[model samples]
Target: MLNLSESINKTLNNFAENTEMMWNFADDATDVLLGDLDTEIASTPYEIVYQQDRVKLKYYKSEAPVKMKTPLLVVYALINRETMLDLQPGRSVVKTFLDNGIDLYMIDWGYPTRKDRYMTIDDHVNGYMDDVVNYILKREKVPQVNLMGICMGGTFCVMYSALHADKVKNLVTTVAPTNFDTDQGLLHSWMKSVDVDRMMDTLGNMPGDLMNFGFLLLNPARLMIDKYQSFLENMNSRDFVENFVRMEKWIFDSPDVPGETFREFIKDFYQGNKLINSQMELGGKRVDLKNLTMPLLNIYGKFDHLVPPGACELLTSRVGSTDVQDVCIDTGHIGIYVSSKCQREFAPKICSWLGERDGNFSEPEVSSPVKKKTSKAKPAALQN
Candidate 1:
């Protein structure tokens, strides 16, 4: 009887201790939440050197002497802003390239509105992208520039390079979905049946918020529930809070996609699987894979849920480039750019690869000052 009484007392003591700990945690969390925190992202400095319509071009000059005579143009998807590459200083892909003596230019597909609803895939790939390339070539006095694309942007780059092979010196694509026939990802399956025509007709431009909601539904356990639970648990840590908030800012800053472009992308790329088969067309010209004869480097995340390896691995086989290489990083979609492990692998590999073929193309003319429309703004996105 005495032992039973002691056991009951111990149980009550444990419960009281847990309650006290919870109160202490709550107090600490409140302090952290209320404290001033620096959560700014895309801190690496850059200049908006060019703008056309709603799209802008960002230029990041290398502090070191430019090693590659050919400058690189990075094309990010219209779904998300280009800020993901320069997310933070220490872990920035932009910083890595700059440190390696690479002169970088990235496309900022600014927020679209009702006016942009009629814009088609041809308008982006053969129009804005083509103009951007021409501007870069003229500004740098180079006949050809190195090309890199990410996600949907990568798909655009593939199309661009194919159509205008003469302007591209070397081509690099990361996590770019080309083959859409496989049922490897949830997006692949869901996009196949997506009634994009109806959605676009009703909404004009595909709403950024609607896209974010759909992405969240892709993996709600991790993206929605557990993510917030982790934030709650670690809210007292300033570092955790700052990083978490920064990511939140980036993820939610989605831009609306032009309706015609979205409709064509869904029908031609995802449902019809036309790109890999060489049946896709832009500006009335067929996007033949055989036309991608420049030096090609295709990189993709092995475990990417959105653009799986199955979608990426087929490009090297179909491209006409004799010099082709494929790299599969062991990570999910966004992790390939933001994770520490990828920091050492992703940008450096490109720098080295480009360095090898930098001299293989038409040499850039002597450096000269060129007039440009310069502006600056917060490097965040409207979508993806």
Candidate 2:
């Protein structure tokens, strides 16, 4: 309703204000992102209680008084670092367990070199895992410790639990693939069709970057393109930028998978589909699911692409235990551990499930590490 000069002045004022606002946002974003930031995770205090050739045992001493008798030992997949479990302060599963008074232990499978290419599943389950279990039992003076594994580590735990049933009091597997017959996941199909033997032979060890590339191909739109696009849109916020960068660090911090282990897993578990059928063997011993007599908790993300529900749901039926629980959370593979909503549900569910089975034994009689045979490839079936 104003004259030409007045209208022009108003328009110019509005344009100038918007430009200034945008410039301010750009400056803030630059400082927040390019400025010195600490993206390094797994910051919770812990002690390297034990170490072997290529792996180290991290025991996170609870800040509060220890309430649980059976200490929890977390075993993560070899493909990625276990830092996902403790990404940050509020979003840390390790912190939740520590706050809940659980004496938590974690196995850090450090970077695998060419020398480790010959380290087969037998070497992992029977050799290193065995030694770690003995060390924990000797220190805690408990007959058995609770074993929880994530993704491929869960598969390893299942094998270790079956082979050495006496050492595992309870078992928990998160997004672990046991039955590989379904077409729900891209990995299952690609693995069946891929030439893993030639790949292993040529590479010596499956490079972490190569494995990550394969995972990205599963859903490029969401993982590669959309995620970063969303980050850009939200980049103006300092908190958003910080969290996004933290996750980026965790995702890219993957380790090379050993060649022998990769070859055996591809042939026996994926191609042969022997885990659920009770035909899988480790260390020359049959990995019978019926040998898993301890209380079991199998968890899978409803939208997990790497290990879909079909791959994880059949464990309860196959295991030898009468006490078994299968939990399907509303999340994806990584979200099951990192997402904020899941932070409320995931660890709580685990603590509850474990608390029910973990007897109210106030003090377990401290005892020496049971002299166990360093059996090369033999199954240590539970005592009847």
Candidate 3:
């Protein structure tokens, strides 16, 4: 009877301790939640050099000397805004590039309206992208510019390089899906069966909210549940809350993809797998992978579910480039750019790779006036 009483006393004490801890956590969380937080993203300063309809070219000037003779044009996917690259000062790919003396240009495929529903892959590739490249080439007075693309943007860069090989000095693709026939990812499986024509006919442009819902469905347990649960647990930390909110802004700030672009991307690339089979066409010309003769750097996340390694790894063999390198980083799709470890690997690799290939040329003078846009509150272990 004495031992039983002691056991009960111990149990009650433990429960009381846990309850006190919970109360402390709640108070701290409330304090942090009520505090002023700086959640603004894409805070890197840039100038808008060229604008065509919804697409704009952003030029990020480096205070350091330009190391590479060839300027880099970064093309991000249409689904997400390019603000993702400049997510935060510490984890920013843009800041890393600028710090490394890379003269950078990025394409901003702005929000698509109902009128943009008629825009197709051909229009984006041959029309807007080509025009952007030409403007860069002329503005910089360089014969060729380095091209890098992310996700769908990488696929676009591949097509652009193949179609206009002479204008591209080197090509870099990050987590870009080229061969989509494999069922390694749920996206590929769903896309294959998706009736894109019907979707486009009914919705005009592919809705951003719908796309976000689909991506959330991809890994609901982690992306939807686990992430928020983590937030609640760490809500007392101001830095944690700030970073969490920044990512939340980027993840949900998805823009609607153009209708015809979405339709063709689904039917041709995902369904028929025409790109890998050499059956893809744009602007009345075949996109011959053999024309990708320039130096190629293909970087993809090993654990990327949306664009699996199987989808990206096949490109090196198919491309005509003799000096090709494939780097498989141990990370997920978005993690490749934002993860802390990758901050060390990702931009440095590009700098060294480009520096080696960057031939001798005097620095070019900036002829165009710096056009500043108002600051809008927006917004990696290598295993090869």
Best by TM-score: 3
lDDT leaderboard ranking: 3, 1, 2
Q: What digit string (tens of lDDT, one per residue) describes model 1 on residues 145-179?
A: 99999999999999999999999999999999999
Worst 10 residues of 2 by lDDT: 365-374
TM-score of 2: 0.88
- Return the candidate ranking by TM-score, descending: 3, 1, 2
**Model 2, range 81-162, lDDT digits (tens) per residue?**
9999989876788887776668999999999999999999889989998999999999999999999999999999999999
Per-residue error at 238 for model 3, in Å? Answer: 0.5
Stretches of candidate 1 off by over 4 Å are: 1-15, 359-384
Superposition-based RMSD of candidate 3 using all C-alpha atoms, in angstroms = 6.7
Worst 10 residues of 1 by lDDT: 370-379
User: Residue 210 deviation, candidate 1, in Å?
Assistant: 0.6
Off by over 4 Å in 2: 1-20, 360-384
lDDT (C-alpha) at residue 235 in model 1: 86
Model 1 TM-score, all chains together? 0.89
TM-score of each: 0.89, 0.88, 0.91
